[model samples]
Target: MVKVLQQATEVDYGFRPSYRKVWMAKQKAIAQIYGDWEESYAELPRWMLRVQLTMAGTVTVLKTSPIKLGDQVDESTMYFHRLFWTFSPSIEAFRHCKPLVSIDGTHSYGKYGGTLLLAIAQDGNSNILPIAFALVEGENAESWSFFLSNLQSHVTPQVGILVISDRHNGIKAAHEAPENGWLPPRAFRAFCIRHVAANFSLSFKGKDARRMLVNAAYAKTEAEFYYWFDIMRTENPAMCDLANRMEYDKWTQHQNSGRQFGHMTTNISECVNSVLKGTRNLLVTSLVKSTYERLAELFVVRRQMAEAQMGIGAGSLRSTRQTGTEHPASVAYNGSHRRP
Candidate 1:
């Protein structure tokens, strides 16, 4: 010991101690976020979240708020996408919801290329509810088809027995894609009113045309729908030809009870954008994941209130249509209630 101290008299290298302390502190912080810290202690109660979600305040607060999970996203962004796009509605919710319909995608604005494709349903009250979502790069047949094929996972065969969306030209091509070849025709797919409006407005361009189109759609009876359509066609001959040649079957879909139909419009899917209006601009790395975390928090509370009103027991509210080949339990559910 005496010999060693004598040799090291001025060689202590005093900066070494503080360097180790800083390194250790950084390691501890990383462990806290990743391993087990209680920060995610379900601080926001379900009911409180619902009250905040009521179309106003909840959405307002979601814009600037951030969470620790933003760091969890990977460098390639592919893994971040696979996690975020596939997480919403939870697999349980997907399994229980029935007659799922209406799929559509819209682009997101930010440095990162992203679009949102959503699968929606009509609740017992006839209001729209979302069951799954995807953040895509652009709106195309490929993206929409991928969303549908992936959506099949959430479905019990009887659950999403019918579905709807804009019947974009690429849809059939995607449906016939080698992987999606096995889906049945009865898992029916159709288009929404927005697609109708887009097709109609392209050929019939006047205030009168707009009124005729909207009125015919809102009409409840077959007679009323056709009577309105007949008048629309009589007023515009060229438009009539386009409707007959290109869109007649589209109008017929609503009239046919032959297949289950969901919503007349894509408004419900678009409604989500309104809910998270400004949150999309907040993060650099995991913007999609961050948006979803806020959405998941919002849905938890929103579903609580929705369930309470429907009188389903606490766990029952999470029920969904059976997917894959599982048999459905015989149960009765009404426009505003569910019973098993």
Candidate 2:
């Protein structure tokens, strides 16, 4: 709160309400942006304040330990090496705003071989919303399963959520595994098309063959997709045989998950990754705190853009995507664009 006072203008929160029911989210985010300021900017114009905040602060303060509150009163002193969840007011920042969720794990460079599993969603507005995240070890079926199970435990479930992710052996099994008396069945899992193609291409020869087969998998319509599948099956019986045996169709779920380009291979998740390239690697305390803060900055930019557009940019709501519809995928803060 002290930091916020230094960074933001004194916008009277009385009478004039510019937001919807989610006022708290907006307020918290505004505080975070200004809270990093070195001195008060109360006299600055609002737009300039936002711009100043975008390039505000130094790295030392960015990585400083969070101010601990009150007196410590804990019995157990277990080392918190892995972080399981993350919270932000703009958590719902996504374009194809849907209850749709995606979960993935990135290996941590820290000791003990750790992995972070992040569960994200699309919010009411079209921002790549981050629901919850977790830190785990060795991203495998057991770890992923526990992560998903924990996510389910935390959030409120929407009617039909189609979760898009890779066909990692662990994740696939975790989705299919008998809930161990827990977890949900409707959490339809989808395999990354690129991963599937790359893995399948490794088994065959010639560039044409790989391209042909890959196209078949991404062919827009189910008819076209299946048509390509059959052609590939004939061209490379071994590949088809491998796919059938592994039941890959059981995981090719996104095509029907009601989102723009769900049928095609869209690496939006990786696009998000490119945004945090170095930041994720610099994470500490088992949590990518720095990454989280940077992401907040990215969201502020998106918020500004969203304000400018004034018009709905396709996947701009928790709405579904279908044939002929186009949506702007979420933008990320590629660290390379550092404002010197």
Candidate 3:
């Protein structure tokens, strides 16, 4: 029965059922298969490690590390401090996406508490592309530094690359620190507008103020930004002063040094977090597996959708040309065609 359910779930979701659900189904099958047997939750960590190890062996360019001491090589020194993983496919896919990447940390509710740090990018079609994932002890300066250091090495931020995230002190310090800061000289950092809006709402009370703040952030030009900003300041000088204290380049689109590609918030990362909510309570390994499987399915589905769209677009272009509605040269072919 458990096997049947697993098959059904994989067919529908491209992955297996959650461990708790599988365990419950196994409980009913135990009497018939193994005669009153049960599995302990404590064994889940080891089981998950085994699965990850197997995956690492099979998947080329797959990286995985279990928690252990940096100095010693003994059982006493071994501990689960963090877990990190990324695959070649994700890294390669990021190269074709926008130069912006959003980083965020979500708390994991597994028996052994930890934080899941993710680095996500946006593709040409504005789809969320998962770049890297790490399970850390917590969201502190040290943990964030470690995660960013690894990410810096992995992704290697280029000139004009944009990093969008919330105003977490750990993240702020990690990127701004002189010695090991992740921000390259050419790259820029921006704050999520939604987070900025929420903070503003807490300090200043009024729907109009909130609307003006958002409008200011989304302004496409300096004149437009100032236009909305003046309204906020005129309505409430104190609130405007507070908002001004935050860096202009970090919140406003017009002031950003790097190309944001029209993204002003870390909502892309947040969307990925929402999808993993159900797996957050699972063991470390299971959570990782769920992320990996779900991402694989997402990539497959989105790629097919994009190809289908391209096919339709090509067909429509051909039909238009045959009907003499527009000449092929007038359709703008890579700067080759020009208007009369």
Leading candidate by lDDT:
3
After TM-score superposition, the amount by which residue 117's alpha carbon in candidate 2 deviates from its true location, in angstroms, is 2.2
The local distance difference test score of each candidate is 0.52, 0.51, 0.74
Clashes of each: 11, 15, 0
In model 3, the number of clashes is: 0
Q: Per-residue alpha-carbon lDDT of model 2 for 248-319, expressed as tens digits?
A: 443343255354234334355555555555444332431345555666786788778766564343333323
RMSD of each: 18.1, 17.9, 8.4
Report the Cα lDDT for candidate 3.
0.74
TM-score of each: 0.58, 0.58, 0.72
lDDT of 3 by residue, 55-98 (tens): 54222122324445577445543345665566656777778888
lDDT for 254 in candidate 2 is 24
Candidate 1 wrong stretches, greater than 4 Å = 1-84, 95-98, 176-178, 181-184, 247-249, 252-254, 258-262, 282-285, 306-340
lDDT of 2 at 37: 23
Model 1 C-alpha lDDT per residue in residues 1-340, reported as the tens digit of each score = 2233333533674333344454444435544543322222222233235544553312111111233465774434222232123343444454444465666666554334367666666654555556666655566666656666666644433532656556677665665565753255536555576677677787767678867776776666778878878997788767556655644334454463544443566676677666655544323223444555665785688788766756653234344433332223433442233334
How many Å off is the CA of 326 in candidate 2?
28
Candidates sorted by lDDT, descending order?
3, 1, 2
